[model samples]
Target chain A: MPPSPVAVSAALNVVEVAAVLAFAISGLLVAADKKLDAVGVCIVAGLTAFGGGTVRDVLLDRRPFFWVERPQWLWGVLLLCVAAMLVLRARHFAVTRKAILWPDALGLGLFTANGTQAAIDLNLPAVVCVLMGVITSVFGGVLRDVVCNDVPEAFSDHRPYAICSFVGAWALIAAEAAGWSLWASLLVATALTASLRLAAVHMNISIPPWDAGGGGK
Target chain B: MPPSPVAVSAALNVVEVAAVLAFAISGLLVAADKKLDAVGVCIVAGLTAFGGGTVRDVLLDRRPFFWVERPQWLWGVLLLCVAAMLVLRARHFAVTRKAILWPDALGLGLFTANGTQAAIDLNLPAVVCVLMGVITSVFGGVLRDVVCNDVPEAFSDHRPYAICSFVGAWALIAAEAAGWSLWASLLVATALTASLRLAAVHMNISIPPWDAGGGGK
Candidate 1:
């Protein structure tokens, strides 16, 4: 039987809210690092928090995005952003440029997992689900970079394991398709991606396409 | 009866492609004015062209957005951007800042109409459609401003009639819902919006409160 409307809505709400918080924190940290004023920080936070979900919905042919449907999601993000700014202010702290990777990776992992789950719930094809997961995980960062007047960091050569999202998302999709429990798939995907990214960051691991002479047979 | 999927897709493809080119050209003009190098110009052009639709899709809860669905669209945009750069190079042309408004207004009108039509097709409420239309038309410019490291000119006092989008989109939605022909409604809306914007530019008229506040409002 089809899921009841209320159940469906509840599930969507839970996932969306969780994902929004994850992304918002990521944006907040980035804004802090950039030393943006409160309004600028809030704008970045809002964009990062909603950017991925909005992309996911538009691609899935969904309408009146979650934020628009329940505007409370936006309000929640706004409040969290304000709270974050206050906390920073109270501590008399400033975020240096060096202080922003962990939260971003964590946010990426959570968003990817949530997007994959949303796709699976919608009964999308496996490839599409994986794509959605990756898009959801990355588009917000892309938007953030553009706003910051930088090339999308994901596409830059210095980025490490940025593609981890696609790898782990595909793995999660496979696991779920193979009958793994939802939470199990989510945990595995999130852990796999985050760990890979952290390790890559620490080890200075890099992808191999730079050597022009190596490609020829 | 449901519309034939093939026909719908075909029409969507044509209109969307046209819209993308129009906006890309507008972006190219802006970048040319700034004397950005090729990479910068391409980035700006692509951002300007796809930015609005990307916003629209996300807001509407769509997934695997049009660009993602067809990676070829990215290639097309890239090629056009390259061509634009070559043309500018060959002619040693300078894009005067003053030359941008007409094409920009045209792009805004087309995008607004297309966005509203998409929302209406999705059966969204009229209010939502008007909002979507405005978002689709203005978001690219907003992103452009952000990338250029400036406040979106629209948000600043110098620009007025940006809200013409909100007004015209609503007018179009009302007309269409009242059983006006699609072409007639679209043309009327676009003409009205473009005229109002051009007049605002010529007359140096501005949005009332925003224009008068002079910042820090």
Candidate 2:
């Protein structure tokens, strides 16, 4: 039997919170690497955790942003930033390349699933729903990179980051079409996306850069 | 006598169009400088023209973006980009530093006034209204710079871009408090902002960087 609507909603909320926490950690690590001040860390962490959802809500014309409606999320992100900063200061914790990957992948999967569902709820077209999913998964990191004066990893990293999100969005859409429960679909999609991202990272997979020479690379 | 409501509305529309056009041109020039492809040019120009207003609308929960409602604006920007590209290719029309300053200043002024008015109409808080105005005037350029892999001129340049917008927003608020007409308020605010920005550019005025040392520079 399919999960009840209430159960699905609760599961999704858990996923959202987990995603927010994971993304915030990734952002805090980047800020620490950049040697930004306290304010910069807070700004980056907030943007990384909430920026994509904010963009999705704005595009969908949803009032009172997700964080705005749940002010606790904002406070939670703030507290996390403060704690992380103190922890980093107290002990010389080196943020290696490997440190951020797991959290980033988990956030990407969860956010992609949630954003796709949100757009589906709004009755947007299928393509747009998928696009929103990709945007929600990737744009926060894009904004974080941009603000930190790094080339947006989403655009230039040549990785499977956005591509994985796109595939997972389709997975959710397909599962829904097959009449699966929302929670089941979310689990499947998130697992697929997260595994694919991790696999890509492990294998050092990459897409070629867009050729400037006018021929498709 | 104060301008009629109809007249004020019409003038604001005109200002919006002019600002969009000027900002689009600035974006196109930047794309050309970076040797981005045609698609890149279109994306940059579109973002530079619409990004700020889109951000303001999203933050304020306004539905159906301005360009989404009036797609002619998007078409107009496309045409402008095409024309500009052809002209630049046909003749080496150097896009000098001076070439961008005037239109950028004008767009900054007009957008600041219109954004402030929009927030005021929504009855937002005074600080939020001022911030919306500044975001409307500057966020587009910030987005364009980010996409082009350049440091956002607004934050790092410290050349009074957002400061001019903030001052203009306050000017409009002050004019309304003094019982001035909408048209008069807009004119005063725009002139003040544009002039200040131009003056800053001309005089090479810049704010000091945040002191990394213990001492405030």
Q: Which candidate number has the best TM-score? A: 2
Q: What is candidate 2's lDDT per residue for B50-73, written digit by digit as tens?
A: 999988887987778788878999
Candidate 1 overall lDDT versus native: 0.72
Give the candidate number with the greatest lDDT.
2
TM-score of 1: 0.56
DockQ of 1: 0.09
lDDT of 1 by residue, B1-217 (tens): 3346665566556657777877887788777777788899899999999998887876666777888988898898899888766655534444434566777777777777777777877877666687678778878977877877765555444445447777789878878768876667777777777777788789887543311112211
* Global lDDT scores for all candidate models: 0.72, 0.82
Classified by CAPRI criteria, candidate 1 counts as incorrect
Error of 2 at B146 (Å): 5.5
Cα deviation at B109, candidate 1, in Å, is 13
DockQ of 2: 0.10
